[model samples]
Each structure stands twice: as structure tokens, then as C-alpha cells.
Target chain A: MLNPTITEILLSLMQVSYITLIVLVVSAICGLILGTILTIIVVKKIPVLKQITVTFSSFTRSVPIIIQLFIVFYALPPVIESMGFSTTYITATVASIVALSLYHGGYLVEVFRAAYRALDKGQHEAADSMGYTPIQKFRRITLPQTIPVALPGWGNALIHLIHDTSLVFALGVVDIMGRGQLIAASSYGMNQVKIFLIIAAIYIVLTFLSDAIIRFFEKKNKKFKLDSGLNTKGA
Target chain B: MNFLILFEDFVQLLAVVPQTLLLAITIFILSILIGTVMALIQEYNVPVLKLIVVIVKLLLRGTPLIVLIFLMYYSLPDTVTFLSGLVGLDYNGTNIPPAIILIVAVSFTVASFQAETIRGSFLSINKGQIEAAQSLGYTPYQMFKKIIAPQALVEAIPEFSSSFLIVMKAISLGFMITVVDIFAEARLIATDNSYYVEAFFAAALMYWAISAITVTLSSKYEEYLHSRM
Candidate 1:
């Protein structure tokens, strides 16, 4: 009773889930890698590089994701084509993933950098005094500690990226919103309202799921703290 | 990569500044006015209105802005017309402008976030200050006007400035619904000239510059407020 095109709605849901999962994985991986690198650069105070990272982060943060998507989707192909790369590979999905990952990566950089900055100066001093290598210090102390600090912001970023996936439909990608568009078009807009309301509900469920997952991690972190008598401060 | 071409592109993008500003400023003002009311309701804990505000805030925050705009611009009219027909009323709801729909959708989202920001600022005001004002024989309105309002307004400025930048970026979404803002204008020029990169690069620069100026101004204002304190 939601809409006459229940099957289309289901298909769109599947498509939406598919796109969201891909985007989530792609953006998470890209964001983490890039964010970590940027955080490290900042932590080390790499002369001009730190300034560059800061500027890049602020610029990316300021730009709208939709504008970024359009720029990448339309502009990137021509640039790639000029570089002797085929533009055929840059579909709407690819453009969406690229733009979304980069956008999320900028935010993740802030989260990761802030988390690093929040750690007590004594932690680094202790590691240094113990003759721990920089890599060892990062792996054994910083990485583990930063996770709890970064989790909430990282979770919010992922949820935001998921919400942004709905915009891929604007690029003609058959995401949930695109699916709604398709169904509305096919049904001559008879069920547009129902289709969109259903899509909104789906988004709500996705965001709630992400929040719950973050809560689960928070609880686990709390339990770990209680057992080990170690606490990671939230900044 | 041509400097002259890029300059031309920047000009084309700049030409649409008026429309972009109109969209951003209009929605921002509406959102702040409406958002303040919504925030005050939650602040005072009005029974039914508080519940409704919570629900509305959640609904707005949970859904993507694009979905809201799409629904308002496209689906709402058909649904309205159909409902009206069922009640034996002849109404055509399709004549509303996309700009108006964009405003409504963007304002709803902005208001939700603004309500939260405004509420936080309100909560940050200490009870002792209000008590002091009360002891001075100040009316409730006078208490708000003289003490609570000043502190909250100063506190709210930093957050409000960032939201102002956000509203500016959001105006780009109006392009999706064909509202002829700067983003839309850039897209048109890019399509016409087939220089997508140059056109969009110009658009990005303009957006970045506006936001950068906003950040600088906001920080300066915040410093001035702190100096006053």
C-alpha cells in the first residue's frame, strides 16, 4: 500500500543499500588513509605541508558536496581524457565515490588531527623515554587511543556520507532518491509523495543504525576502560 | 588552463552572485527567525509545542536536504492536488516557484540545526544572572533583553556565522532544481562551452572565497565580542 510500484521501490532500496555500502567502504578506507597521513603531517609540523593540509581541509570543508560531485563528474572526465586516460570508466557511481571519499577524507582529517592533538603530551614523552620507535609509538599507543576519540566524529561523517549518497541520483545514478525519481516518472508522478516519504524513512533508519553502532563501540570502550583502568579522553 | 578563459569563466560565475545571495540571504533570515522561535519553545519547555519541535527537528535532521527539496518541489503539489480533488476542491498546486520550494526546504533544515545551536546558547546562560536581574526588579522581558539576550547573542554569533557559510554552500543545491543560482549558471556555461573544468573551477573558487571571507569576518567579530567582555 506504500505505492503501486512496490517492486520498483524494493529494487530502489536494494540499489540504495548497494550504493551506500560501496560509498561507505570506499569513503571509510580513503578517508582513514588520507586523514591519517594529513594528521601525521600536522603532528610532525611538516613546514609548509602542515599549512597546505590546513588550507586544503578548510577549503574542502567549505565547498558543498553537490558542487564537488558536479565538478568531479563533469570536469574530471575531460581532464583525465586529456591525460590519455579513457573517460569511459568515470561513471556516475565512480564520480560519486570519488567526490564523497574526498569530502569525507577532509572531515576525517580534522577528526584524526584533533584526536591526536587531544592526547596528553606525557604520552608522547613516555614513548620517547622508553626508546620506542616512531612507528612503534604510533602503532602501540596513538592508534589505539585515537580510535575512541575519533569514533563519534567518524560515525557522524559516515552517516553524513550515507545521506549524501541520495544526491548521486542527481547525477543519474539509481540510488534510493534516483529510484524514487524513476518510479515517479514511470507512474506519471502519481505516487511521488509516497515514494519520497518511504525514501526518507529509509534514510532515517540508516542514520539510526549508524548511531547505534557508534553507541555499541562507545559501550565497549567504556567496558574496556573499566576492566583495564585505562581511559581515553574525549575532546 | 588558459588564464583569459578562466577569467571569463569567473566573470560568468560572478554574474549570478545576486541570485545566489538572494537565495542564501533570504533562506538564512527566514531560518534564523523561525529557528529562534523553535529554539525558545524548547528552551521554555512548552508542552505540546516542545514535542512537535523535537519531532520536526528530528525529521529535518534525519532526512537529506535534497530529498526534502525534491519532495517539496515535485511531489507535494501532486499530492496536494489529489487530496484537494478527493475533497471536491479544484486546486492547482504546481505553480509555485522552485526558488520558494528551495527556500522552504533549506530553511527547514537550517532551522532544525539553528534551533539546536540557539538552545545550547540559551542553556549556557547561568541561572544566577537571571536571578540577579529579578532581584533588581527587572521584568522577564527586561531580564532577557538586558542580560540573557546579550550573552546568548554573543555566544550564538560564532555558530551563526558558520551556519551562514553553510547556508551559502546549500544555495548550490538550488541549482539541482533549476533555480538559476551561481552553480546553475556555471553548469549552463560549462554545458554551452564544453569547458566543464574551467567553469566549475571558477564556481569553486567563488564559493571558497566567500566562505573564507566569512570565516575571517566571524573570527574578527568573535574577537571583538571577547574584547568587549
Candidate 2:
């Protein structure tokens, strides 16, 4: 058996990047929506909703991602079937996305909550005194300020999401890691080291690229802070 | 869901808790030792070694723990064989236990994060205090013992505990390499009974309970440190 060619490796990595990008975007959006709702429930101390949100977050955080993936993969089909829906369409990738999105939301709750709480009480009071409605206040005063503060944490969460997506291969998703497994198995386990090394290098490069992108946004957010005079005021 | 099977699965999973905890503790100790060395190298700006440490940390941080485990699983045997051959030990790589590979690989991954945590704690120490200690004619060891170690340890406790949780969690990946920890046992039980949800939930509950206990104990320890100060 021969080693996999460079093109095969690159092609597999490209597929990995593509799948990871999709998971990242979809999960990040879902997580943000879930996180924002949970933050509201917790911050406003909404009765039952707050308890459920807290419990759910803790559950997600405690379990390993792989276990969560397995749970979702196995449990979701039965759930949908019980609801009188077809379960055939729920692929490993879909389950992976659902589990990972929940995981991301679980973590982002704390991030957003911390960022939201870190906002000055004066800002809220000032908005109220200005006769601004709640929506108007949130959109104008709360969002812009909270975003710059949350940007760093959000970036860190995104990096984590990238890493977590690698576990999807365990569910038989043909991501780079899965592709490496296939290649190694095809070669009768020859060149297993080389295949894994290439995969690891690809992951490192992906992380480096994402880190640079995150830093870029962080810098941009810093400028937004300066323009809004948040720095001078030290809020 | 069959409640009886779930209860049985939970009991079966519980049997492997000691193995999981042992792996976690060993990995935590090894990683802390390795990470501190990396942190000290970076802290003191050890010339060429610092650069290597930084690069290795970057690589480790970017790569997922699962990938590291797989990489080690595949590569370590050959590397071990080559090294032993050079030393004329006539050892076979196949003799290495998968748990050892799991420990080494996971330690490298966890240690990178630990190194950053420790280095940050070291930097958190006030420069003024160090200057005061120096001007007071304190030796290096004295400065570390009297001025730096206590403060840095306190600062590091929160991050250290979180890293410990991470170490605990990472041990679950050991199942992928055939380590018969809680996760592996859970997987076996699930396969036997086809009750995936119950098996995983039991494992998750065990993990959560352990994490909660760790968190409480660490916080208590932190409080004790504070009270002594």
C-alpha cells in the first residue's frame, strides 16, 4: 500500500474546512440566539425559565462533547419520531450541529451574561431618564457598548467551537480527522503517523488563521471603543 | 427507556470511576510539572528554549485534544521503538500501555493551557513588591518564597481548578484509545443494551457530580488560603 498523495490530503483538508465553516456559522448563530434568551431569563430573574436555563446550561457544560454528540444522535431520532415526524433525515452531521450548537449556547450564556452585567448601571439609568423605550434603549445604548466588551469572550468561544467541531468525525462525518482515519485504514494502518501529522498541521493552520481574524476584530472593536469615548470614561 | 437497564448501566459505569479519577490525577500532576517548566522558561525569557516553548504551546493550543490523542496513539509506538533501539534496550513499542500514551498526549495538550495560566499568575504579581524584595537584600529564593509564591499561588487557584476540570473532562477521550474508564464502560454497556441515552446520561451525571465536588473543594481551599493570608 502506498502513502496518500498531497492532493488527497489537501482535498480532505478542504472538505474539513468547509464542514467546519458551516458548523461554525450555523452554531454560532443558533448559540447567540439561545444565549441571548438565556441571558435575559437569568438577568431578569424570570421564574421557571431562569431555573430551566440554568439547569440546562450546567448539564451541557458538565458532559463531554462526544457524549453529548452521542446522546443527541441517539435521542433525537426517537424524539422526532415520537412527535410524529420522520427521523430518516437526521444525519450524523445534523446531530453534530445540534449538539455543538447547544454546547456553544451553554458556554456563551456566561460570556454574554458577564458582558451584560459589566455594563454600567449609569447607562441604563441615563437611557431611562432620556425617555427612551426599552427596545430603543437596548438597540441604541446597550448593544453597542455590550458588543465591544463581549467581543473578546465571543472570539474565544468561537475558537473553542472550531476545536469542538473536530469531534464530529466520531459520529462518522468525513471531516479531515475522519478522512485521515479512512486513509490510514485503507493503507492497512501504514502511514498512520504521517496522516495524523498532516491533520494536526491543518488544524494548527486553521486555528492560526482564526486567531488572526479574531485579533483583527478585537482591534476594530477597540477603535469603536475609542470613538464612543468608552476608554476615556473608563466605563 | 428501560429504567432497570438505566439503573444497571449507572452501576456499571460507577465501577470505572476510580480508573477515571486515577488517570485524571496522574495527568494533572504530569501536566502541572511540564507546564510550570514551560511557564518558567517563558517567565524568565530563557533565550532559545523560550521560543521553542512558545511555538509548541501555540501548536498544542490550536490542535484539538482528540487529534493529539490519535496522533500519539499512532506515532508513539514507532518513536518509542526508534529511541529504545538507539539505547540498545531491545524493547518493543507494542508493550506500551494505551493509558500511558493517553496520559502523555493529554498532558501536553493540558500543559500548554496550564503554562499560560501559570505565566499569567506570575505576571500578576506586582513589580513594585519584587523591587522592594530585591532592594531589601532578599535572595532569589527568599523573594520567591516570601514575596512571589504565595501571591501567585492565590492568583493561580481559580485558573488551576478550571484546568483541573479540563483535565478531568479530557480523560473521557481516553476511551477512543481503548482505556477502560467510565466512558469506555458506558459505551460498552450502551452497546450491549442499546440504551445509548441512559448510558451517556449516567456518565454525564458522574462527570457533573465530580466536577461540582472539585469546584466546591477548590473554592474552600482558596478561602482557606485567603484566611491564612
Candidate 3:
């Protein structure tokens, strides 16, 4: 029955941005590391570990992220406590980051693996001929190429992650969605649609901004590669 | 980790499988129907509707589905009342079910994704074939039916399956709206059994099983399609 003021809407949007920023930054960093590790484990085909990692990735990928969120938020602490670990300090935000990173990391592993597979065998051979060690070859040759190829998919994962951060509200995190609910609740259940429409618009703008940023990097990467003259068959 | 409790919870959660599956099926069918229309509109490049389609796609795809769900579940009655008022009709608009609202919200988001998939397939259709069809004096409908649909369908199948999986995963969010889907059932079981970990684990297994089956079926269907080609 009450309209949210311009200031209230703007303030809520700002708060949402802060929460989203935290989740995105944390998930992106942790997911990249986790994904890379999973990719390597699979690619190197480690005994037992490879199969286990593959299954874990597959399972995580198949299940909904919200389910994963619930597991991490609710199930994991008890499981951890049963194993003699304390999780008293694991707040909702931490749970959200952990769940989201794991969820996105599963997809990122596929992207990294596929990008690595797409590279020509000659690249590896060339690195080997140069007396480069495995790690050195990966650092100097493999990563550079894989990054460009994986960037678009990674960008998509980031966008998806951005949308998913809203689900943190289900954990009662007072994120943007939570704030919208609060606004609606304060209005005695009125203006629910109007408030959410505004919030959704803000999200659309955020999504557009992320897309533009990713596109800009993609273009810059292309230009940098062409100028460096590594633009061979891989290019 | 009580086995008996987990088993009981699993059985209880199983009862909601039909609701979950029906929601997924309804959303999948409606989204595909809407997606096909959007794709066709894009193909024709209808002036005003094309702009609206692009805007709708961006809006739906850009926003999180939960927000849309809240919008739909909370706003539909008000919207109905407003519309009815404009038309001079008496309406209270309170009998709508949450499941229907969830389906409509999720379908709007999924339809945008499906539209993109269909549009990509349409874009992949050969320009030369279209020109040849035109030279043969084929109408737009005839050209689409004979020359475009089959080719696009082949290209679209993989994306369609992926979208189908997405729709399946998405309905789990319906639990947030208290739709009594399996996920919601799991929460209730957890509250009742006080074994949150075990209850959620059982639910996860169920979700994983459905997803695995869908993936297997899609791959097999893809193989069959390839064999025909």
C-alpha cells in the first residue's frame, strides 16, 4: 500500500550491488582456482582422484545451484561438526560464496577442459622442443591460449553467477532480493510487483554492464594477440 | 545420518515428484511454444514486435528468476484486478495457484533462452537455400516449412536438450514459493525429522538421478538424429 521512495530504492540497489560484488569477486577467484585444479586432475588422469573429481564435477553440474546452496548452508555445517570441526562462524555470506563458487566451478572446469583440448598438438610439441618443463609449458603456452578461448564461457558463467547471487536471499542474507522483500513487507504486502520490477530493471542494467565489460576485454585480447603475431592456426 | 529417517523422508519427497515433473513439463512446453514464436518473429524481423521481443528477452534473461517469481506470485492478483477494473468487470482474482505463477515466471525466463537457441539455429540456415527457395516462388511459410525447419531442428536439438535440463533445474526454485515440490518437501522433512543433512542428501540424490536420466536420453536422441542425417 506504500510506494518505496526514490531514495529507498536507490539505497537498496546500492546494498544489492555491494553484496553481489562480494559474491562475484569471491566466486570468480575461488571458482577459477577450483576449476583449474579439477581440469588438471581430469586432464592428467590421476588414478582414482580423476574419477572422483569427474564425478563430483558432474554431480555438481547436474544438480540445481539452490540445492547445492541448501546443502552447503544447512547440511555441510552439521557434517563438518560430526567430523570434529567447528562451523559456528560460517555465516550466510560465507555459505553463499562457497556454494556459488562450487556450482560455477563445475561449469568452469568443462570450459577450461574444452578450451585446453581445442589447442593444436603442435603447441605442446613446440613447447616440449624448447626444453620447457610441464609447468613452464602450461604457464607460458597453454594458459595464454586457454584463457582467450575460455574467456567467453567464463564471462557467461559470471553473468549467471550474478543472477544467482540473488538466491542468497533464500538463506535470509538481506541481499537485493531480500531487500525487495523487505520493502514489500514494509508496505503491508502492497507494491510487491512495482518494487520487484524496479529491482529487476536494476539487475538488467547490471547484466548489461557485465556483458559490455566482458566484450571489451574480448576485443582487447584479440587486438593484443594479433599485434603479438601469435595469430596462427590457434588464432 | 539416520537411515530409517532418511528413507522415510525420501519416500515422502517422492510423493512430490509428480508435481515437480509436471511443473517442468508445463514450463518446457510453454517455453518452447513461446520461444518458437519469438524465433519466428525474429526471422521475419517484424518491426515493432521485433523490438519488443529483444527488450523482453533482455529483461527476462537479465533478471534472476526468483525476482520474477516474487513479481508474479505477488503481483498477479493486483494486475488482474487492475485489468478487470479497466474493463468494468467484477473480479477478486485470489484463486490462482502458486504453481501456475511459478510456471509462468520460469517459462518467461526459459522462453528467452529457448528463443536464442532457435534464433541461432535459424541464423545457421544457408542463405543460398533461402535464395533458391525464393527463386522457386515459394511463399515465406512454404520456405520455412520445407527449407528451414528441418535444418534448424537438427541444429537446435542439442541446445533444446540443454534448455530442457535448465528448465528441470529451475523448477527447484518453485520450492521457494512454497509450491510443495520435492525441494520444498525436503525442507519439510528436514524440519520434521531434524536430520537436515540426511534429508537434503536424499533430495540431492533424487535430483541427480533425474538429471542423469535426462542427459542420457538426450544423448541417445542426438545419436539417433545424427544417424538419420
Question: Reference contacts recovered by each candidate, as fractions?
Answer: 0.67, 0.70, 0.74
Q: Score every model by TM-score.
A: 0.90, 0.95, 0.92
Q: Which candidate is the best by DockQ?
A: 2
lDDT of 3 at B208: 84
Return whichever of 1 and 3 wins on lDDT: 3
| Model 2: residues with Cα > 4 Å off, grouped in runs | A13-17, A224-235
What local distance difference test score does each model get? 0.81, 0.85, 0.83
In terms of lDDT, the poorest run of 10 residues in model 1 chain A is: A223-232
A134-218: candidate 1 lDDT, tens digit per residue: 9999898777677776787888787778778878777888766776777777777677767778888888887788789888997
Q: Interface RMSD for each candidate model?
A: 1.4, 1.0, 1.1
Docking class of 2: medium
Residues B1-229, model 1: lDDT tens digits: 6667778999878888877888898999999988999998987889999999999887876798888887788766777789999999999868767888889889989988888888889889999998899999999888888898789988898899989988888878887778988778888988898887778778888888888888899889988987997
Clashing residue pairs in candidate 2 are: none
The best candidate in terms of TM-score: 2
Tell the DockQ for candidate 1: 0.63
The clash tally of candidate 2 reads 0
Cα lDDT for residue A52, model 3? 87
lDDT tens digits, residues B20-43, model 2? 888899999899899999998988
Sorted by DockQ (best first), the order is 2, 3, 1
